[model samples]
Target: MITSYNFYFCYIEIHEDYVKAVMKEGITVSPEHNDVLLQIVEKHYKNIPFVYITHRINSYAVDPTIYLETAKISNMVGFAVVSEDPKQKIQIKLEKTFFNKEFKQFDTLELALKWKDDMIKKYRD
Candidate 1:
């Protein structure tokens, strides 16, 4: 997995097949930052099947549209987000739209990773 993080954002790139990768950091609400993020994801990782977000809401509000676009491009089959803030609801809606369905959410990254691992095993078989 490849990772990138700035003061305002963070991302991870999973480079395995039959195995999914996830970004543990959440993104900020800035349009510019989101744009930069999209470019990065597009440029470096476009085929990952799963992505996990761990950015806290206080640091930055993640725009769901950005994640939606990423999922669209990555053809991401599943997503797990860990946030304690209610504001993340908006992102959740956006994720659902991007996935055309609901995604799993957890309060901790460990749960998300465990779930993703189980999912990968299921999908791989």
Candidate 2:
């Protein structure tokens, strides 16, 4: 498990098949935050399709517009955001339309990883 605090509000963790990010409570997650994540993913893992899993542990706001530019990254084959919040669930539904890659929300990390594995296989095939 690789871990680093890219920003005081955001902590980045890398796994074998994906990256898990945790943000400090109530911070607005914007394009700048997404940019840092993309750079980290590009720098550590290469040549194989992988996932960006946001393990939401705190209340925060996200800019759905970032999805447009995020979709343009070919290596980012899927996005798995794990959350159990009802309010965030609604926001996630709205964000889905802007995301070009496979996107889903889950209640647990195990399920999210399973979906990520399946997506990677699907895209590679």
TM-score of every prediction relative to native: 0.57, 0.92
Give the candidate number with the greatest lDDT. 2
Per-residue accuracy of model 2 over 28-112 as CA lDDT, tens digit each? 8888877887777778777768898898889889889999988888888898889998888999999999997789999999999
- Tens digit per residue, CA lDDT, model 1, 1-125: 44434433444443442223233344345446556556655565466544444434344455556554555544445566666667665666566665543377777766867776776566557
Q: List the residue pairs that clash in candidate 1.
A: 24-54, 26-55
**Alpha carbon lDDT of each predicted model:** 0.52, 0.85
Report how far off residue 8 is in candidate 1 (Å).
Answer: 4.2
RMSD of each: 4.8, 1.4
Q: Among these predicted structures, which one has the highest TM-score? A: 2
